[model samples]
Target chain A: MNGVHDLGGSDGHGPINPEPNEPVFHAEWEKRVFGMFLPVAACGYFNLDEFRHAIERMGAPSYLNTSYYEHWLHAFETLLVEKGALSAAELAARQQQIAEEAR
Target chain B: MASSAHTRPLSEVEIRVKALESLLVEKGLIDLAAVDALIDKYEHKVGPRNGARVVARAWVDPAYKARLLSHGTEAIAELGYTGMQGEDMVVVENTPEVHNVLVCTLCSCYPWPTLGLPPVWYKSAPYRSRVVIDPRGVLQEFGLQLPESTEVRVWDSTSEVRYMVLPERPPGTEHLSEDELAALVTRDAMIGVTKVSA
Candidate 1:
Protein backbone atom coordinates (compact mmCIF):
# COMPACT_ATOMS: atom_id res chain seq x y z
CA MET A 1 0.00 0.00 0.00
CA ASN A 2 1.26 3.46 -0.94
CA GLY A 3 1.13 4.96 2.52
CA VAL A 4 2.57 8.24 3.76
CA HIS A 5 6.05 6.88 4.54
CA ASP A 6 7.14 7.11 0.89
CA LEU A 7 8.27 10.73 0.89
CA GLY A 8 11.21 10.43 -1.51
CA GLY A 9 11.47 13.41 -3.87
CA SER A 10 8.65 15.26 -2.23
CA ASP A 11 8.84 18.74 -0.68
CA GLY A 12 8.34 20.84 2.49
CA HIS A 13 10.79 18.74 4.50
CA GLY A 14 13.37 21.30 5.55
CA PRO A 15 17.03 20.56 6.16
CA ILE A 16 18.97 17.40 7.06
CA ASN A 17 20.46 18.80 10.26
CA PRO A 18 23.00 16.26 11.44
CA GLU A 19 24.31 16.22 14.96
CA PRO A 20 28.08 16.02 15.14
CA ASN A 21 28.96 12.68 16.73
CA GLU A 22 25.55 11.26 17.42
CA PRO A 23 25.36 8.58 20.10
CA VAL A 24 24.18 5.09 19.21
CA PHE A 25 21.10 5.57 21.35
CA HIS A 26 19.92 9.01 22.45
CA ALA A 27 18.49 7.83 25.78
CA GLU A 28 18.21 4.68 27.84
CA TRP A 29 14.55 4.21 26.94
CA GLU A 30 15.29 4.72 23.27
CA LYS A 31 17.87 1.98 23.57
CA ARG A 32 15.38 -0.34 25.19
CA VAL A 33 12.72 0.18 22.54
CA PHE A 34 15.21 0.00 19.71
CA GLY A 35 16.55 -3.16 21.28
CA MET A 36 13.08 -4.72 21.45
CA PHE A 37 12.52 -4.37 17.69
CA LEU A 38 14.61 -7.23 16.29
CA PRO A 39 13.74 -9.77 18.99
CA VAL A 40 9.98 -9.27 18.67
CA ALA A 41 10.19 -9.40 14.90
CA ALA A 42 12.29 -12.53 15.14
CA CYS A 43 9.51 -14.23 17.08
CA GLY A 44 7.44 -14.50 13.87
CA TYR A 45 4.99 -11.84 15.01
CA PHE A 46 5.64 -10.05 11.71
CA ASN A 47 8.33 -10.11 9.10
CA LEU A 48 10.54 -7.10 8.45
CA ASP A 49 8.52 -6.13 5.38
CA GLU A 50 5.20 -6.06 7.24
CA PHE A 51 6.75 -3.90 9.93
CA ARG A 52 7.95 -1.47 7.27
CA HIS A 53 4.52 -1.55 5.66
CA ALA A 54 2.94 -0.87 9.01
CA ILE A 55 5.12 2.22 9.45
CA GLU A 56 4.12 3.31 5.94
CA ARG A 57 0.49 2.80 6.86
CA MET A 58 0.76 5.29 9.74
CA GLY A 59 -1.31 7.84 7.79
CA ALA A 60 0.52 10.83 6.30
CA PRO A 61 0.00 13.50 8.93
CA SER A 62 0.79 11.19 11.82
CA TYR A 63 3.68 9.64 9.98
CA LEU A 64 5.33 12.97 9.39
CA ASN A 65 4.58 14.21 12.91
CA THR A 66 5.88 11.18 14.77
CA SER A 67 9.48 10.39 15.68
CA TYR A 68 11.38 7.52 14.04
CA TYR A 69 11.19 4.96 16.88
CA GLU A 70 7.64 6.01 17.64
CA HIS A 71 6.82 4.76 14.19
CA TRP A 72 8.45 1.47 15.11
CA LEU A 73 6.52 1.18 18.36
CA HIS A 74 3.25 1.95 16.61
CA ALA A 75 3.94 -0.68 14.00
CA PHE A 76 4.87 -3.16 16.72
CA GLU A 77 1.54 -2.61 18.40
CA THR A 78 -0.41 -2.76 15.17
CA LEU A 79 1.20 -6.04 14.18
CA LEU A 80 1.14 -7.66 17.60
CA VAL A 81 -2.57 -7.04 17.90
CA GLU A 82 -3.25 -7.83 14.28
CA LYS A 83 -1.38 -11.13 14.58
CA GLY A 84 -3.31 -12.10 17.77
CA ALA A 85 -0.25 -11.99 19.99
CA LEU A 86 -1.95 -9.18 21.86
CA SER A 87 -5.37 -7.59 21.74
CA ALA A 88 -6.44 -3.96 21.51
CA ALA A 89 -8.26 -4.24 24.81
CA GLU A 90 -5.21 -5.53 26.58
CA LEU A 91 -3.02 -2.82 25.08
CA ALA A 92 -5.52 -0.16 26.09
CA ALA A 93 -5.59 -1.52 29.61
CA ARG A 94 -1.82 -1.44 29.74
CA GLN A 95 -1.84 2.15 28.58
CA GLN A 96 -4.37 3.02 31.25
CA GLN A 97 -2.23 1.42 33.90
CA ILE A 98 0.77 3.31 32.63
CA ALA A 99 -1.13 6.60 32.65
CA GLU A 100 -2.30 6.05 36.20
CA GLU A 101 1.21 5.16 37.34
CA ALA A 102 2.61 8.28 35.77
CA ARG A 103 0.25 10.49 37.79
CA MET B 1 11.97 16.40 24.66
CA ALA B 2 8.22 16.52 24.74
CA SER B 3 6.40 13.49 23.43
CA SER B 4 4.76 13.46 20.00
CA ALA B 5 1.03 14.02 19.57
CA HIS B 6 0.36 10.61 21.11
CA THR B 7 2.12 10.36 24.43
CA ARG B 8 4.01 7.33 25.66
CA PRO B 9 6.27 9.15 28.09
CA LEU B 10 8.90 11.88 27.93
CA SER B 11 10.26 9.96 24.96
CA GLU B 12 6.74 9.14 23.67
CA VAL B 13 7.58 5.60 22.59
CA GLU B 14 9.42 4.33 25.64
CA ILE B 15 6.64 3.24 27.94
CA ARG B 16 4.58 1.73 25.17
CA VAL B 17 7.52 -0.26 23.96
CA LYS B 18 8.17 -1.44 27.49
CA ALA B 19 4.54 -2.41 27.74
CA LEU B 20 4.75 -4.34 24.50
CA GLU B 21 8.05 -5.87 25.54
CA SER B 22 6.77 -7.11 28.87
CA LEU B 23 3.70 -8.63 27.28
CA LEU B 24 5.77 -10.28 24.59
CA VAL B 25 8.25 -11.64 27.09
CA GLU B 26 5.43 -12.91 29.29
CA LYS B 27 3.90 -14.68 26.30
CA GLY B 28 7.27 -16.14 25.30
CA LEU B 29 7.04 -14.33 21.97
CA ILE B 30 10.33 -12.58 22.68
CA ASP B 31 13.21 -12.53 25.11
CA LEU B 32 14.64 -9.52 26.89
CA ALA B 33 18.13 -11.02 26.95
CA ALA B 34 18.06 -11.51 23.19
CA VAL B 35 16.94 -7.92 22.76
CA ASP B 36 19.84 -6.77 24.95
CA ALA B 37 22.24 -8.78 22.85
CA LEU B 38 20.91 -7.18 19.67
CA ILE B 39 21.38 -3.69 21.08
CA ASP B 40 24.83 -4.55 22.39
CA LYS B 41 25.85 -5.80 18.98
CA TYR B 42 24.77 -2.68 17.12
CA GLU B 43 25.79 -0.32 19.88
CA HIS B 44 29.25 -1.69 20.65
CA LYS B 45 30.40 -4.24 18.08
CA VAL B 46 29.16 -2.54 14.87
CA GLY B 47 28.99 1.02 13.50
CA PRO B 48 30.33 3.53 10.97
CA ARG B 49 33.84 2.71 12.13
CA ASN B 50 33.45 -0.73 10.55
CA GLY B 51 32.31 0.97 7.35
CA ALA B 52 35.22 3.39 7.54
CA ARG B 53 37.61 0.44 7.65
CA VAL B 54 35.91 -1.03 4.59
CA VAL B 55 36.22 2.24 2.72
CA ALA B 56 39.82 2.64 3.79
CA ARG B 57 40.69 -0.88 2.70
CA ALA B 58 39.10 -0.20 -0.67
CA TRP B 59 41.07 3.04 -0.91
CA VAL B 60 44.38 1.25 -0.33
CA ASP B 61 43.78 -2.11 -2.00
CA PRO B 62 42.63 -2.18 -5.62
CA ALA B 63 41.77 -5.87 -5.58
CA TYR B 64 39.68 -5.50 -2.46
CA LYS B 65 37.95 -2.51 -3.98
CA ALA B 66 37.12 -4.51 -7.10
CA ARG B 67 35.78 -7.32 -5.00
CA LEU B 68 33.73 -4.82 -2.99
CA LEU B 69 32.29 -3.17 -6.07
CA SER B 70 31.44 -6.50 -7.64
CA HIS B 71 30.08 -8.21 -4.52
CA GLY B 72 29.35 -5.77 -1.66
CA THR B 73 27.69 -8.28 0.64
CA GLU B 74 30.54 -10.74 0.48
CA ALA B 75 33.23 -8.07 0.61
CA ILE B 76 31.57 -6.43 3.60
CA ALA B 77 31.18 -9.82 5.26
CA GLU B 78 34.89 -10.35 4.67
CA LEU B 79 35.44 -7.79 7.42
CA GLY B 80 32.78 -9.54 9.58
CA TYR B 81 30.13 -6.85 9.17
CA THR B 82 27.22 -9.15 8.23
CA GLY B 83 23.71 -9.20 9.67
CA MET B 84 20.11 -8.19 9.08
CA GLN B 85 20.45 -5.15 6.86
CA GLY B 86 23.88 -6.15 5.60
CA GLU B 87 22.54 -9.19 3.69
CA ASP B 88 22.39 -7.46 0.27
CA MET B 89 24.87 -4.61 0.41
CA VAL B 90 25.63 -2.64 -2.77
CA VAL B 91 28.71 -0.46 -2.79
CA VAL B 92 28.40 2.75 -4.81
CA GLU B 93 31.39 4.94 -5.45
CA ASN B 94 31.44 8.71 -5.72
CA THR B 95 33.46 9.73 -8.72
CA PRO B 96 34.27 13.09 -10.28
CA GLU B 97 31.31 12.80 -12.60
CA VAL B 98 28.76 10.91 -10.46
CA HIS B 99 27.49 10.80 -6.89
CA ASN B 100 25.24 8.21 -5.28
CA VAL B 101 22.87 9.06 -2.43
CA LEU B 102 20.66 6.46 -0.75
CA VAL B 103 17.14 6.81 0.61
CA CYS B 104 14.54 4.25 1.55
CA THR B 105 11.56 6.41 0.41
CA LEU B 106 9.08 4.11 2.10
CA CYS B 107 10.69 3.62 5.50
CA SER B 108 14.11 3.87 7.11
CA CYS B 109 15.56 0.77 5.48
CA TYR B 110 19.27 0.98 6.28
CA PRO B 111 22.35 -1.24 6.35
CA TRP B 112 22.52 -1.59 10.11
CA PRO B 113 25.62 -3.71 10.65
CA THR B 114 27.94 -1.29 8.88
CA LEU B 115 26.23 2.05 9.46
CA GLY B 116 24.59 1.38 12.81
CA LEU B 117 21.11 2.89 13.21
CA PRO B 118 20.40 5.78 10.87
CA PRO B 119 20.26 9.33 12.16
CA VAL B 120 16.84 10.87 12.71
CA TRP B 121 17.13 12.88 9.52
CA TYR B 122 17.93 9.82 7.41
CA LYS B 123 14.54 8.47 8.49
CA SER B 124 12.85 11.85 8.15
CA ALA B 125 10.26 12.79 5.52
CA PRO B 126 12.39 15.72 4.40
CA TYR B 127 15.39 13.60 3.49
CA ARG B 128 13.30 10.75 2.09
CA SER B 129 10.81 12.91 0.17
CA ARG B 130 13.17 15.53 -1.21
CA VAL B 131 16.40 13.63 -1.90
CA VAL B 132 15.13 11.77 -4.96
CA ILE B 133 13.55 14.71 -6.80
CA ASP B 134 16.01 17.33 -5.61
CA PRO B 135 19.22 15.50 -5.02
CA ARG B 136 21.44 18.47 -5.65
CA GLY B 137 19.34 20.73 -3.45
CA VAL B 138 19.42 18.20 -0.65
CA LEU B 139 23.15 17.68 -1.05
CA GLN B 140 23.59 21.41 -0.85
CA GLU B 141 21.68 21.42 2.40
CA PHE B 142 24.13 18.83 3.69
CA GLY B 143 26.92 21.31 2.79
CA LEU B 144 28.03 19.32 -0.25
CA GLN B 145 28.14 21.30 -3.47
CA LEU B 146 28.96 19.53 -6.72
CA PRO B 147 29.56 20.81 -10.23
CA GLU B 148 26.48 21.36 -12.36
CA SER B 149 27.78 18.77 -14.80
CA THR B 150 28.06 16.03 -12.17
CA GLU B 151 25.50 13.23 -12.22
CA VAL B 152 23.49 12.53 -9.05
CA ARG B 153 22.07 9.04 -8.77
CA VAL B 154 19.48 8.70 -6.06
CA TRP B 155 19.33 5.02 -5.08
CA ASP B 156 15.84 4.74 -3.66
CA SER B 157 16.09 1.58 -1.59
CA THR B 158 12.64 0.21 -2.33
CA SER B 159 13.69 -3.26 -1.27
CA GLU B 160 15.97 -5.15 1.08
CA VAL B 161 19.15 -4.11 -0.72
CA ARG B 162 21.14 -1.39 1.08
CA TYR B 163 23.75 0.98 -0.36
CA MET B 164 26.97 2.46 1.03
CA VAL B 165 28.84 5.31 -0.68
CA LEU B 166 32.57 5.08 -1.25
CA PRO B 167 33.53 8.74 -1.04
CA GLU B 168 36.40 9.93 -3.21
CA ARG B 169 39.52 10.18 -1.06
CA PRO B 170 40.81 13.68 -0.49
CA PRO B 171 44.10 14.74 -2.02
CA GLY B 172 47.56 15.08 -0.30
CA THR B 173 47.34 12.11 2.05
CA GLU B 174 49.84 9.54 0.75
CA HIS B 175 51.58 9.32 4.14
CA LEU B 176 48.42 8.22 5.94
CA SER B 177 48.13 4.51 6.79
CA GLU B 178 44.91 2.53 6.41
CA ASP B 179 43.90 3.28 10.01
CA GLU B 180 44.52 6.99 9.47
CA LEU B 181 42.49 6.87 6.28
CA ALA B 182 39.70 5.10 8.12
CA ALA B 183 39.68 7.87 10.72
CA LEU B 184 39.03 10.41 7.97
CA VAL B 185 35.96 8.56 6.64
CA THR B 186 32.88 10.12 8.24
CA ARG B 187 29.51 8.47 8.52
CA ASP B 188 27.92 11.19 6.39
CA ALA B 189 30.38 10.49 3.60
CA MET B 190 29.45 6.81 3.69
CA ILE B 191 25.78 7.90 3.58
CA GLY B 192 26.55 10.33 0.68
CA VAL B 193 25.21 13.27 2.66
CA THR B 194 28.61 14.95 3.06
CA LYS B 195 32.22 14.69 2.01
CA VAL B 196 34.97 13.26 4.15
CA SER B 197 37.09 16.13 5.39
CA ALA B 198 40.79 16.06 6.36
Candidate 2:
Protein backbone atom coordinates (compact mmCIF):
# COMPACT_ATOMS: atom_id res chain seq x y z
CA MET A 1 0.00 0.00 0.00
CA ASN A 2 1.46 3.36 -1.08
CA GLY A 3 0.20 5.15 1.97
CA VAL A 4 1.59 8.34 3.55
CA HIS A 5 3.19 6.13 6.15
CA ASP A 6 5.79 5.05 3.59
CA LEU A 7 7.74 8.26 4.14
CA GLY A 8 11.04 7.23 2.56
CA GLY A 9 12.73 9.82 0.33
CA SER A 10 9.88 12.29 0.80
CA ASP A 11 10.68 15.86 1.85
CA GLY A 12 9.44 19.12 3.48
CA HIS A 13 8.47 17.42 6.78
CA GLY A 14 11.04 19.55 8.70
CA PRO A 15 13.89 19.05 11.16
CA ILE A 16 14.28 16.13 13.55
CA ASN A 17 14.23 17.44 17.10
CA PRO A 18 15.43 14.83 19.53
CA GLU A 19 13.93 15.17 22.96
CA PRO A 20 16.20 15.30 25.98
CA ASN A 21 15.43 12.92 28.85
CA GLU A 22 12.35 11.62 27.16
CA PRO A 23 10.20 9.18 29.11
CA VAL A 24 9.38 5.67 28.02
CA PHE A 25 5.86 6.87 27.18
CA HIS A 26 4.40 10.36 26.87
CA ALA A 27 1.03 9.51 28.44
CA GLU A 28 -0.67 6.91 30.61
CA TRP A 29 -2.93 5.96 27.75
CA GLU A 30 0.18 5.24 25.68
CA LYS A 31 1.37 2.86 28.37
CA ARG A 32 -1.99 1.10 28.28
CA VAL A 33 -1.81 0.82 24.49
CA PHE A 34 1.74 -0.53 24.64
CA GLY A 35 0.80 -3.06 27.29
CA MET A 36 -2.06 -4.34 25.19
CA PHE A 37 0.19 -5.33 22.27
CA LEU A 38 1.54 -8.67 23.50
CA PRO A 39 -1.72 -9.82 25.08
CA VAL A 40 -3.73 -9.08 21.96
CA ALA A 41 -1.13 -10.70 19.74
CA ALA A 42 -0.90 -13.66 22.13
CA CYS A 43 -4.62 -14.34 21.63
CA GLY A 44 -4.04 -14.43 17.86
CA TYR A 45 -6.22 -11.56 16.76
CA PHE A 46 -3.58 -10.40 14.26
CA ASN A 47 -0.03 -11.10 13.26
CA LEU A 48 2.78 -8.49 13.12
CA ASP A 49 2.44 -7.73 9.41
CA GLU A 50 -1.33 -7.48 9.64
CA PHE A 51 -0.93 -5.05 12.51
CA ARG A 52 1.58 -2.95 10.52
CA HIS A 53 -0.71 -2.98 7.49
CA ALA A 54 -3.60 -1.76 9.59
CA ILE A 55 -1.52 1.23 10.59
CA GLU A 56 -0.47 1.74 6.97
CA ARG A 57 -4.13 1.66 5.95
CA MET A 58 -4.92 4.66 8.14
CA GLY A 59 -5.99 7.88 6.46
CA ALA A 60 -3.19 10.26 5.58
CA PRO A 61 -4.34 13.17 7.72
CA SER A 62 -4.68 11.27 10.99
CA TYR A 63 -1.70 9.05 10.26
CA LEU A 64 0.68 12.01 10.11
CA ASN A 65 -0.92 13.92 12.97
CA THR A 66 -1.32 11.25 15.63
CA SER A 67 1.23 9.98 18.16
CA TYR A 68 3.06 6.67 17.85
CA TYR A 69 0.94 4.81 20.39
CA GLU A 70 -2.16 6.33 18.82
CA HIS A 71 -1.11 4.50 15.66
CA TRP A 72 -0.99 1.28 17.69
CA LEU A 73 -4.45 2.04 19.08
CA HIS A 74 -5.67 2.55 15.54
CA ALA A 75 -4.21 -0.79 14.45
CA PHE A 76 -5.83 -2.69 17.33
CA GLU A 77 -9.16 -1.07 16.54
CA THR A 78 -8.90 -1.72 12.82
CA LEU A 79 -7.64 -5.29 13.05
CA LEU A 80 -9.83 -6.47 15.91
CA VAL A 81 -12.92 -5.32 14.03
CA GLU A 82 -11.69 -6.74 10.74
CA LYS A 83 -10.65 -10.04 12.36
CA GLY A 84 -14.13 -10.50 13.92
CA ALA A 85 -12.72 -10.27 17.42
CA LEU A 86 -15.17 -7.43 17.95
CA SER A 87 -17.63 -5.53 15.81
CA ALA A 88 -17.21 -1.90 14.78
CA ALA A 89 -20.43 -1.00 16.53
CA GLU A 90 -19.20 -2.56 19.74
CA LEU A 91 -15.99 -0.55 19.55
CA ALA A 92 -17.93 2.64 18.98
CA ALA A 93 -20.27 1.94 21.85
CA ARG A 94 -17.39 1.17 24.17
CA GLN A 95 -15.61 4.33 23.08
CA GLN A 96 -18.71 6.38 23.78
CA GLN A 97 -19.09 4.78 27.19
CA ILE A 98 -15.47 5.52 28.03
CA ALA A 99 -15.81 9.12 26.96
CA GLU A 100 -18.89 9.53 29.13
CA GLU A 101 -17.24 7.91 32.13
CA ALA A 102 -14.25 10.18 31.79
CA ARG A 103 -16.50 13.20 31.87
CA MET B 1 7.31 20.63 19.25
CA ALA B 2 8.11 21.89 15.78
CA SER B 3 4.52 22.44 14.69
CA SER B 4 1.29 23.36 16.43
CA ALA B 5 -0.46 20.43 14.81
CA HIS B 6 1.84 18.01 16.66
CA THR B 7 0.43 19.19 19.98
CA ARG B 8 -2.96 17.50 19.71
CA PRO B 9 -4.51 16.55 23.04
CA LEU B 10 -4.22 12.98 24.29
CA SER B 11 -7.68 12.88 25.91
CA GLU B 12 -9.45 11.58 22.83
CA VAL B 13 -6.78 8.94 22.30
CA GLU B 14 -7.00 8.03 25.95
CA ILE B 15 -10.73 7.45 25.68
CA ARG B 16 -10.34 5.30 22.61
CA VAL B 17 -7.59 3.21 24.15
CA LYS B 18 -9.53 2.69 27.36
CA ALA B 19 -12.52 1.54 25.41
CA LEU B 20 -10.47 -0.89 23.36
CA GLU B 21 -8.71 -2.32 26.40
CA SER B 22 -11.97 -2.69 28.34
CA LEU B 23 -13.58 -4.50 25.47
CA LEU B 24 -10.60 -6.79 24.96
CA VAL B 25 -10.46 -7.57 28.66
CA GLU B 26 -14.21 -8.26 28.79
CA LYS B 27 -13.82 -10.72 25.91
CA GLY B 28 -10.91 -12.46 27.73
CA LEU B 29 -8.53 -11.46 24.98
CA ILE B 30 -6.26 -9.43 27.26
CA ASP B 31 -4.62 -10.50 30.48
CA LEU B 32 -3.92 -7.73 32.99
CA ALA B 33 -0.96 -9.52 34.57
CA ALA B 34 0.63 -10.14 31.22
CA VAL B 35 0.19 -6.50 30.32
CA ASP B 36 1.74 -5.37 33.59
CA ALA B 37 4.63 -7.77 33.15
CA LEU B 38 5.32 -6.51 29.66
CA ILE B 39 5.27 -2.90 30.83
CA ASP B 40 7.62 -3.62 33.71
CA LYS B 41 10.01 -5.50 31.46
CA TYR B 42 10.19 -2.72 28.89
CA GLU B 43 10.03 0.21 31.26
CA HIS B 44 12.60 -1.05 33.71
CA LYS B 45 14.35 -4.29 32.76
CA VAL B 46 15.09 -4.19 29.03
CA GLY B 47 16.45 -1.28 26.98
CA PRO B 48 19.45 0.05 25.07
CA ARG B 49 21.56 -1.22 27.93
CA ASN B 50 21.14 -4.67 26.41
CA GLY B 51 22.53 -3.46 23.12
CA ALA B 52 25.31 -1.58 24.89
CA ARG B 53 26.42 -4.76 26.58
CA VAL B 54 26.49 -6.55 23.23
CA VAL B 55 28.55 -3.78 21.62
CA ALA B 56 30.94 -3.69 24.55
CA ARG B 57 31.57 -7.43 24.37
CA ALA B 58 32.11 -7.28 20.63
CA TRP B 59 34.61 -4.46 21.09
CA VAL B 60 36.66 -6.57 23.49
CA ASP B 61 36.46 -9.95 21.74
CA PRO B 62 37.60 -10.33 18.14
CA ALA B 63 35.99 -13.77 17.72
CA TYR B 64 32.69 -12.48 19.11
CA LYS B 65 32.89 -9.42 16.85
CA ALA B 66 33.42 -11.70 13.83
CA ARG B 67 30.48 -13.85 14.88
CA LEU B 68 28.23 -10.80 15.52
CA LEU B 69 29.05 -9.29 12.13
CA SER B 70 28.37 -12.61 10.36
CA HIS B 71 25.40 -13.95 12.36
CA GLY B 72 23.73 -11.06 14.16
CA THR B 73 20.62 -12.81 15.41
CA GLU B 74 22.46 -15.82 16.78
CA ALA B 75 25.25 -13.74 18.32
CA ILE B 76 22.77 -11.36 19.95
CA ALA B 77 20.79 -14.35 21.22
CA GLU B 78 23.99 -15.59 22.90
CA LEU B 79 23.65 -12.59 25.21
CA GLY B 80 19.89 -13.27 25.79
CA TYR B 81 18.52 -10.54 23.49
CA THR B 82 16.32 -12.34 21.01
CA GLY B 83 12.58 -12.27 20.19
CA MET B 84 9.92 -10.16 18.56
CA GLN B 85 11.31 -7.44 16.26
CA GLY B 86 14.85 -8.56 17.01
CA GLU B 87 14.45 -12.07 15.62
CA ASP B 88 16.44 -11.11 12.55
CA MET B 89 19.32 -8.81 13.40
CA VAL B 90 22.13 -7.19 11.42
CA VAL B 91 24.93 -5.43 13.29
CA VAL B 92 26.57 -2.87 11.03
CA GLU B 93 29.99 -1.75 12.19
CA ASN B 94 31.24 1.82 12.02
CA THR B 95 34.88 2.13 11.02
CA PRO B 96 37.22 4.99 10.14
CA GLU B 97 36.36 4.72 6.46
CA VAL B 98 32.67 3.71 6.70
CA HIS B 99 29.75 4.72 8.93
CA ASN B 100 26.31 3.13 9.29
CA VAL B 101 22.91 4.17 10.56
CA LEU B 102 19.50 2.52 10.99
CA VAL B 103 15.98 3.63 10.14
CA CYS B 104 12.58 2.32 9.14
CA THR B 105 11.34 4.74 6.52
CA LEU B 106 8.05 2.89 6.11
CA CYS B 107 7.18 2.60 9.80
CA SER B 108 8.66 2.44 13.32
CA CYS B 109 10.11 -1.02 12.86
CA TYR B 110 12.84 -1.22 15.54
CA PRO B 111 14.68 -3.86 17.52
CA TRP B 112 12.46 -3.99 20.58
CA PRO B 113 14.15 -6.86 22.39
CA THR B 114 17.53 -5.13 22.07
CA LEU B 115 17.15 -1.33 21.90
CA GLY B 116 13.60 -1.27 23.30
CA LEU B 117 10.95 1.08 21.89
CA PRO B 118 12.26 3.78 19.57
CA PRO B 119 12.19 7.46 20.45
CA VAL B 120 9.43 9.71 19.12
CA TRP B 121 11.70 11.43 16.59
CA TYR B 122 12.86 8.12 15.09
CA LYS B 123 9.22 7.31 14.22
CA SER B 124 8.35 10.79 13.01
CA ALA B 125 8.06 11.73 9.31
CA PRO B 126 10.90 14.24 9.29
CA TYR B 127 13.57 11.77 10.35
CA ARG B 128 12.22 8.90 8.27
CA SER B 129 11.84 10.64 4.89
CA ARG B 130 14.82 12.96 5.13
CA VAL B 131 17.46 10.50 6.36
CA VAL B 132 17.34 8.15 3.38
CA ILE B 133 17.74 10.86 0.72
CA ASP B 134 20.09 13.13 2.64
CA PRO B 135 22.15 10.95 4.92
CA ARG B 136 25.03 13.40 5.26
CA GLY B 137 22.69 16.32 5.84
CA VAL B 138 20.65 14.45 8.50
CA LEU B 139 23.83 13.26 10.17
CA GLN B 140 24.92 16.90 10.30
CA GLU B 141 21.60 17.78 11.93
CA PHE B 142 22.42 15.23 14.62
CA GLY B 143 25.64 17.28 15.26
CA LEU B 144 27.60 14.40 13.74
CA GLN B 145 29.74 16.10 11.11
CA LEU B 146 31.59 13.41 9.21
CA PRO B 147 34.75 14.09 7.23
CA GLU B 148 34.49 13.76 3.43
CA SER B 149 36.73 10.74 3.70
CA THR B 150 34.10 8.60 5.47
CA GLU B 151 31.37 6.96 3.39
CA VAL B 152 27.94 6.93 5.02
CA ARG B 153 25.69 3.90 4.71
CA VAL B 154 22.08 4.12 5.78
CA TRP B 155 20.30 0.81 6.36
CA ASP B 156 16.53 1.11 6.17
CA SER B 157 15.03 -1.64 8.30
CA THR B 158 12.49 -3.88 6.62
CA SER B 159 9.86 -5.97 8.38
CA GLU B 160 12.23 -8.94 8.41
CA VAL B 161 15.68 -7.58 9.26
CA ARG B 162 16.46 -4.92 11.87
CA TYR B 163 19.82 -3.07 12.12
CA MET B 164 22.00 -1.82 15.00
CA VAL B 165 25.25 0.07 14.50
CA LEU B 166 28.32 -1.31 16.21
CA PRO B 167 29.99 2.03 16.86
CA GLU B 168 33.72 2.29 16.84
CA ARG B 169 35.33 2.03 20.27
CA PRO B 170 36.65 5.45 21.08
CA PRO B 171 40.33 6.07 21.74
CA GLY B 172 41.72 6.18 25.32
CA THR B 173 39.30 3.42 26.40
CA GLU B 174 41.89 0.66 26.44
CA HIS B 175 41.98 0.64 30.25
CA LEU B 176 38.19 0.35 30.62
CA SER B 177 36.59 -3.00 31.45
CA GLU B 178 33.72 -4.41 29.40
CA ASP B 179 31.15 -3.12 31.88
CA GLU B 180 32.79 0.30 31.94
CA LEU B 181 33.00 0.28 28.16
CA ALA B 182 29.30 -0.58 27.97
CA ALA B 183 28.59 2.42 30.16
CA LEU B 184 30.05 4.66 27.45
CA VAL B 185 27.76 3.26 24.71
CA THR B 186 24.73 5.49 24.22
CA ARG B 187 21.57 4.68 22.30
CA ASP B 188 22.30 7.38 19.72
CA ALA B 189 25.76 5.94 19.11
CA MET B 190 24.36 2.46 18.49
CA ILE B 191 21.83 4.03 16.08
CA GLY B 192 24.82 5.71 14.33
CA VAL B 193 23.55 9.28 14.63
CA THR B 194 26.52 10.13 16.89
CA LYS B 195 29.86 8.62 17.74
CA VAL B 196 30.68 7.00 21.05
CA SER B 197 32.98 9.43 22.83
CA ALA B 198 35.55 8.45 25.44
Give the lowest summed-lDDT range of ten residues in model 2 chain B: B1-10
Q: What are the TM-scores, per candidate, against the unseen true structure?
A: 0.92, 0.94
Show model 2 residue runs off by greater than 4 Å: B1-10
Candidate lDDT values, in order: 0.83, 0.90
- Name the runs in model 1 displaced over 4 angstroms: B1-12
What does the lDDT read for residue B118 in candidate 2? 92
Best by TM-score: 2
iRMSD (Å) of candidate 2? 5.6
Q: By TM-score, how accurate is candidate 2?
A: 0.94
| Model 1: residue B100 alpha-carbon error in angstroms | 1.6
In terms of docking quality, model 1 is medium
